[model samples]
Target: MKYVALFLIFLAAPALAQDDPAVAARAAAKALEQASEQLDDADSARDRVKALTTTVRAYEDGLSAMREGLRRVSLREMDLRADLAEREAEISDLLGALMTIGNSEAPVLALHPSGPTGTARAGMLLADVTPALATRATALKEDLKEVSDLRQLQQEAEQRLTEGLQGVQLARTELSQAIDSRTDLPRRFIEDPVRTAILIAGTDTLNDFAAGLGEITQDEEPGSLPAISDRKGYLELPVPGKILRGAGEEDAAGVERPGIVVGTRPRALVTTPTAATIRYVGPLLDYGLVTILEPQADLLFVLAGLDQVYGRIGQVLPAGSPVGLMGGEMPAADEGLSQSGEGGGAQWTETLYMEVREGDDPVDPLTWFSTDKG
Candidate 1:
């Protein structure tokens, strides 16, 4: 819906994505690449990563600010347009009044002379004079000037609105691309052997990362939970669906695993509460069309079983909004393929998997999400 403030109007219903951590990471990395491209100085890998992360965060902020500015500009333009319309109407009314005064049917004098015409000579003389004509001419000129000025103002406002709207749209597009880039960036930098080593480090690392994110504990029993602040709430499913799997399972019912899972009817929109940065938004093993949201550094939100992702990374969004709809689930055999970072572009026909990580460890998402009877 368009936001209406008094006479102003602004479009506020554009889709927002930016809820995945992978997207954020990619953006951060790309920003560094751009900077390095321009600079002659050599920087360490760690330094580049740090610089890129900061730049990505700045761009995310820029996207949010641009969206807001566009909204305001649109509203202003609407008001200006309305004003122009009123001015035009006023000019028309003035012209009508002048026409009425100049019409020949209405004689000016009430007194009728005893002539063949039954009209006073003085009255006839005055009606024929140009005094009334001069007055009407002056009024017309003034009204025309007013109309012209209003039109000029309207045009300027429209131009501003156009530019602002374009900026906002461009920022959105950039963020989306940045997210896609970031989700794949890690794969380029970290080879399979390194990633496998990272994965094998232990679930404790995953748990610690998840703990930092403040996601629901896998085992919230005594001595099992970690210390972390609660989020506003877990990312709510945009619509009804079923929870398919938790993160980091080697096998499910005699099948290999890749990412976690969530199953839904075809084309059901997925969403999270509030806006968040995207951690990863792409295809993964078993988790077809996956997206990961990092509400904060400590919390990671993963979404799978999407037909398409609506939002981009580094963009803010509201919870329970549509991230994407459900596609086919991943097959058990292909589940582990995601870990290998090889298989992609496969159509959905298997189970869905989802994960929530703080940093590296995968935490049980079931504790936070409402029960799925399916």
Candidate 2:
């Protein structure tokens, strides 16, 4: 029976911890500190960029946790206020009764007890109850003090939330600045202004544009480029998200597209899964801003649906370099259907359309990245 009772107590501990706002706040703080340490320990520019992005995300998460803690504290304050009000009412009633009895005449007081013997018994009862009343008054005073302390805590939490939000904003600015400064990469291709202009003007669709790019010749063969073929099924995703559509999947327009769509958080940072040279970074038709990267002499990666592009054309970028940011809210893919309906609703704010091609042939991205389908 003792062991069973101990086991039950252990089982209930986690539930109690979950209810504690301070526990969540501490966890968020710890995560933020670890991310900051990673950012400080980063060796390469690419690693530093990723670390900075993670730190920014951690800061945002910490602020959210703090705000949740504040909310819980506010709720507790309300409960304390209600309890204090009830205690005050009880104290008022007790004081009113004492005043009424004190103002009564001696004869009236004796009559209230019925006779001499009854009056003496009543006095003895009052003597015993007076101590109990004093204890209740002391408890009420302590409750009032606790309510004051709770109000102070509530104020502190609100102030901390405000400061935390400002700190997160500052951290985001620093991350962006770090990415902008780290743009040095060994180039494998030279920009062909004439051919690029012709392709930009002639292409009617993304497929055509990709095909046109494939035909453009490189200036020199990059012997120093990393072997991307050897790293198949081991590449990390450019952004943290879930795969929404696979290669050759039918899109909302009922067209068979040759890319995967990933659903990510709004304004999420897009990074390179492997070392690559920037072939192009500009706006394309319907896909918003686009970035094209060549990981190898024969392999090209196309990324679209960006709100802003970071690197420039012909720039060499190492693996994990920041490429762009996901776009914000936009109109739905189809107009007649609700956003929640399949293919009819508003386009997701952070949907990344990625395509991997080897020598003009589209390849399944799932074969490259280790993704959790479940």
Q: Residue 327 error for model 1, in Å?
A: 1.9
TM-score of each: 0.32, 0.61
After superposition, candidate 1 runs with Cα above 4 Å error: 1-228, 231-235, 246-260, 328-351, 372-374
Q: Model 1, poorest ten-residue lDDT window? A: 1-10
* Candidate 1 structure, TM-score to reference: 0.32
Taking the tens digit of each residue's C-alpha lDDT, what string does model 2 give over 1-374? 23223323323432111254445444655555565555555434455667776666665455445545545545555665765565464457655555555687756654434678888876666555556555555655665675676567556655555555455556556677776777545566677778878898898987678778745545745464667788988888887777888888798888888889998755666888888888788888877889988887767888889887887677788777778877663222122211122321222347898888877688887788889841
In model 2, how large is the Cα lDDT of residue 20?
A: 48
lDDT of 1 by residue, 1-374 (tens): 01012112111223222232223323433443443332222133334323333333333333223223323333333444555465565445445544654674564433465663656664564454435444545854653564455445434433433433343334334434443544322111112334333433433433332343222212222221133346333435434445455445556476543345655433333566445554445555444676767655456777666666765433444344345545543232112222222122232233445665645655666655555534
C-alpha lDDT of residue 68 in model 1: 31
| lDDT of each candidate versus the true structure | 0.42, 0.65
Candidate 2 overall lDDT versus native: 0.65
Residue 370 alpha-carbon offset, candidate 1, angstroms: 2.2
TM-score between model 2 and native: 0.61
